[model samples]
Target: MLRAAVIGAGHIAKQHLAAIDAAPGVEAVGVCDLSAALAELTAERFGVTAWETDFRRLLADCRPDAVHITTPAATHLAIAKECLEAGSHVFVEKPIATSLEDLERLAAVAESSGRWLVEDHNYLFNDDVQQLLRLHREGRFGDVLHVEVQVDLPLFAPGSRFVDRHAPHPAMREPLGAVSDFLTHLSYLANAFVGPIRSASCQCRRDSPVATGAISEFKALVDAAFGTALLGVSTGGEIDRFRIRVDGSRLSAEVNLFEVGAILTRTRGGPKPLIPIRNMVGRGFSELRNARRSLSRKLSGGPGPYEGLWRLVAEFYARCDRGEAPPVSLDAIREVGRWVDVITHAACDNATVSERQPEAVGP
Candidate 1:
């Protein structure tokens, strides 16, 4: 069995630990956190024998085949490089790296080390996402013409939407806040169906009260193989919804990533009365499929529903087991990173443009 270690003990780290335990042919060798208490607690909960506050010691002692870096975006590069140099494969949380330079640098080290460096772009592995891709492949949605992604999550309680003193979300005050952390998911999902982006335009605003000087709402326009799509994100939304709509040549589809639901409709180029009947039939089939997936997740005793954390971890270890290249390509990582840079530049005022451009960086 391959051994695995988790470096960060944040909210996301728990998911990694659990997935590691459930993954076949993989064992949770140890866990490391900045806080000794947290590290010990997590290790005990997972029945792991090793736990330490010092990451350097954890790597030297545990000698794991793979390391999952679930720390914040800021510390990913350093920890990942250390893990790679220590002769361990790396399973990292996303956005890969915040800046283009850091991503390129990490890609460089990871390559030279001859190790697998995979990112937890987990939602793309969800059953809902897979079904959507299947529909496109089956010619149900002939030629994705255009698509739009709308992600809405409430950042605070109903009474307090915004405040300068007490920011609702920890990310509000951070450099890009949710823009960098959450939007990356949407961007990658867009790539799954929309194809590679050509150009992008971004707009951000403070939609709530108080003078926090944080951007709580934003939108991006991307020109891509699916033509163009409007990407929307609102932290002040009343409803917590993660949905993307694709307008294709033959049919249109609305998919909810969080709930693992999808609805496809064939509207245009069809007779007036027949369209309603067709949509009714389509909705029935969609509901049936969603119900089956939800039930399967509940009984499978795997990681939680539609999260796909378990599936992603399993795939990463499988690659490590076979001594193969990373499942996700570095080119795809660079494309997503490049678009994020462009959007953040266009959103913020007086943002410094990067002198170095993104290139193909991998082993």
Candidate 2:
């Protein structure tokens, strides 16, 4: 069995641990966290052999073949470097690094150490997304016209970690604050569907009283070589949701990331008046199918929440065993990192200019 360990036993850390446990041919050797209680609790739940407060000690004692870093973004660079140099593959959470320079450095280290450094863009492996990719590959979806991706999270909800004042989340320290946190997902999803973003424009604002100075709403329009994409990130919605809609030359499809199904629409070949009716019937059928699938999963307790994360972990382990490249290549990481920088920087710059503007005076 391949020995695996985890660091930073926070909320998401549990998911990483669970994925590690579920993956075949992998064993959770240890877990580490700044808070001994959190680490111990997580280790106990996962049935890990050991828990530590210091990662270096875990490295020495457990001697894992791979390390999963579920810590804050600020600490990812250092932790990943140490793991890679220690001869352990590193699997880190999204936005592996906030800056392009840091991504380059990590890539170099991974190359030198002959270890794989994979980021957790697990949404790419989501069931809905996988189905969409399969459709595209099967020649069912034609040339892409545009893509829209939206993620609305409850960052400012009653007990959200982001709203904690004493020890604010690392995302709150980012240039765009909490809004920048979800942009990493948007960047990769858009790049995957619409292609590389050539240029971009953004609109951002800070309107949530609960969120204080963080940007609570953001939207962007990016131009890619072949098409364009519209992306939105917000913390204002009552329902936390993630969804994507792809418009292609031949048909259009929409997938709700929170759910496990997709709806595809295309031209209906029938009488003019019946075309609309046929389209409506098609959508109804799709919804019924989705409802059935969702219910089945719920009843069977099969692939519950974060199914993509589980799939990603399994695939990563399989690739490592076969001596293959990671799911997200170095070049792909660099591309996503570059776009993330562009979008976040643009939003921050816009916020700065807005802050500097003088208020309207009585005329």
Candidate 3:
């Protein structure tokens, strides 16, 4: 079994631990966090042998074959680099690195060290989203004309370290914002289904305390090689929702993340068109409505969707082991890094004007 250590015992770290436990041929050997107490707690809870406040100590002592970096956005680059240097494959959380420069450096380290580096854009692991990608690739939707994506979720509570109260720390604020945090999933989805983006433009606004006047709503128009797409992202709402609509000549497919299912509608150039395909994957929370449903069945069930993500990571490492090509190449990650830079810069500039213009508006 591949021994893995997780860095950062934060909220998302637990989810990573659960996914790691679910993945076959992998074991959690150690855990590290800035808070020694939290690290100890996580290690004890997960039945790990090692725990430490300093990740370097864990790297040297525990000597895990792989490391999962789930720390804050600002610390991703340094931690990932350290892990790579220590001869461990690294799995980093989303928004891979704060800057393109750091991203390039980490890529170089991974290349030189012959270690696998995988970025966790977990949305790609969602079975429904994967099915959508497959159907789009199979041409079930016909020639794609345009794509639209919408994502909105609640933010961390006030005074949380996640929400910066003072001047924006570019690294922390840029990637953690609604546009980068949530909409990047759509961006990745768009790249997966549509072609490479040629050019893009966006307009955004920040309206609430959750985001602390950070950009909460963002709308973007992207020019893809195949066609164009419109992306809309928002937070500061009571609901957590996501939707993707792909329009085509013969049919259309709509996937609702909140509903956990997809619907395909077909049409012909005649009266009374037909709705051909309607497939539902998960229970859609219908089981939650019934008190009789067993919690064990609901929780411990279903082919774990994150298995594919683990497989992807494992394939990356196997490639490294065999001197084969990395599954998600550095070139691809660099391209992603470039797009993230553009989007982050655009959002920052827009937020500055939006903040100032409001005071300039009236008295």
Candidate 4:
């Protein structure tokens, strides 16, 4: 069995631990966190016997074959390096590194250590997304012409660290503030559907007063190898939504990540006058089927919101067992960081230029 451990016993760590448990041939050997209580609680909940307040101690004592780093993005680089150097494969939460330099260094260490390094691009593994990818791969979509992705965040929710009066969340310290936390997801999704980003133009806006100079809205138009992409991220929205739409030569498809639903459009082979009505009925049936499938998944006590995470964790372990490539290739990881870097620079530069514009002097 593959022995795995987890560091950072916070909100996301719970999902990682659960994935570890559900994955076959893998065991949650240890759990670690700065908070001793949180570590113990998480370990106990997962039936793991070893719990440590110090990551070094866990690494030495448990000597796991793999470690999952669910800590804040700022700490990912250091923690991932340590895990790799300790002769353990690493599964790191996204935005594996904030900058290209760190990503390159991390990749080097993983290569030299002969250990796997995988990023938790969980969204790419979502059921709907997986289905969409399969369809694309099968030529159902022909060639992707355009892709659009949008994520609406609830950063201003009561008690969220973004708005914390004291000791705000580490994400609030990122270059893009809380939005950086989700850009990795957007980047990887874009990479998956649109290919390597050739160029991008971004606009940033600060509509919420939560963080000083931190953008609450981000929009980007990108040119890619396969096609064009429009990306959006907003922290000022009242309701959270994650949607991805792709237009192709033969069909168009959209998926609601939060709701786990998908819609596909194509030209129907029928009388031109009747095609519209037939397509509408087909869409209605598609939605109904999606709703039923989602309901069945929920009622069956499936992975729920973290279905993608579970699948990713499981796939990583399986790949390790087979001595195959890591689920998220190092090249893909670096590409994601590059995309984040470009978008961040573009957005920050735009914000700075906007701020520097002289105020109107006219009455």
Top lDDT hit: 4
Consecutive 10-residue window with the lowest summed lDDT within model 3: 354-363
Cα lDDT of model 1 by residue, 247-361, tens digit: 8888888877656578878866578889889799879988898778767766776665436777778887887788766667677777777767766665664333332376665
TM-score of each: 0.88, 0.93, 0.80, 0.93
Residue range 169-220, candidate 3, lDDT tens digits = 3333564364666555677766666666666767877676555556667787
User: Positional deviation of 227 in candidate 4, in angstroms?
Assistant: 0.6
Q: Candidate 3: lDDT of 358?
A: 11
Residue pairs clashing, model 2: none
Which one wins by TM-score: 2 or 3? 2
Cα-based lDDT for every prediction? 0.77, 0.83, 0.69, 0.85
RMSD of 1: 3.5
- Model 4 scores a TM of 0.93
Report clashes for each candidate as comma-separated counts. 0, 0, 0, 0
lDDT of predicted model 2: 0.83
How well is each residue in 1-363 modelled by candidate 4, as lDDT tens digits? 999999999989999998999999999999999999999999999999999998988999999999999998889888989989999999998778777677778888898899999999999999999988998899888889999989987787778888887878787787788788788888898789888877777888887775667777889888888898888988877886899998998888898787767888886477878877877888999999989987887787777868999999999999999999978898898777777777777776663211121223221
Clashing pairs in 4: none
lDDT of 1: 0.77
List runs of model 3 lying over 4 Å from the truth.
Answer: 156-172, 209-212, 268-327, 350-363
